[model samples]
Target: MLLLLPVLPTPEFWITLGNYVGLYSIVAIGLVLLTGVGGMTSFGQAAFVGLGAYSTAYLTTQFGLSPWFCLLVGLVITMASAYV
Candidate 1:
């Protein structure tokens, strides 16, 4: 079932699928917090998510860094961007 899906799809497909799911889940959680809890609708959450993805891609590709390390840097970058 769930375990068989990765075998059926190409590695690239799974990687892309995983990225989209992760991005969407983060956005959804942000939206829930912003709109449901704060009672506000703002597009800034999407920008922060994009900032994170951009930093992750840039760091990983440009510097050939570890994906895990790049992702952590991206998270910090995103938080700092939002704070600024």
Candidate 2:
């Protein structure tokens, strides 16, 4: 005997929720790489996240790049930045 909530999410809500889950999954994977096996201490997770934000901004505003291409550019830039 369980009660159901009166208001349920619409289709758009479901779509948005799904998108967030996918994005979060990627970020969680990155955290694992940075902390779990790499054993890197993070005083700068926000900086890494900011790098991603800038990459998205630059790709969208400067280059008119697609999201997928922007993601690739961001990954390469982040890895290179970390190495240096």
Backbone N/Cα/C clashes per model: 0, 0
lDDT tens digits by residue: candidate 1, 1-84: 878876785688778888889878978888999999999989877788888999999999999999989999999999998788
Q: TM-score of the candidate numbered 1?
A: 0.72
* Candidate 1 weakest lDDT stretch, 10 residues: 5-14
Candidate 2 residue lDDT tens string, 1-84: 113322554478766787789878877887899899899978687687779768977987888888778978887887788778
What candidate 2 gets wrong by more than 4 Å, as runs, is: 1-13, 32-40
Q: Local error of candidate 2 at 30, Å?
A: 3.4
RMSD of 1: 2.9
What is candidate 2's TM-score against the reference? 0.61
Give each model's whole-structure lDDT.
Answer: 0.89, 0.77
Taking all chains together, each candidate's TM-score versus the true structure is: 0.72, 0.61
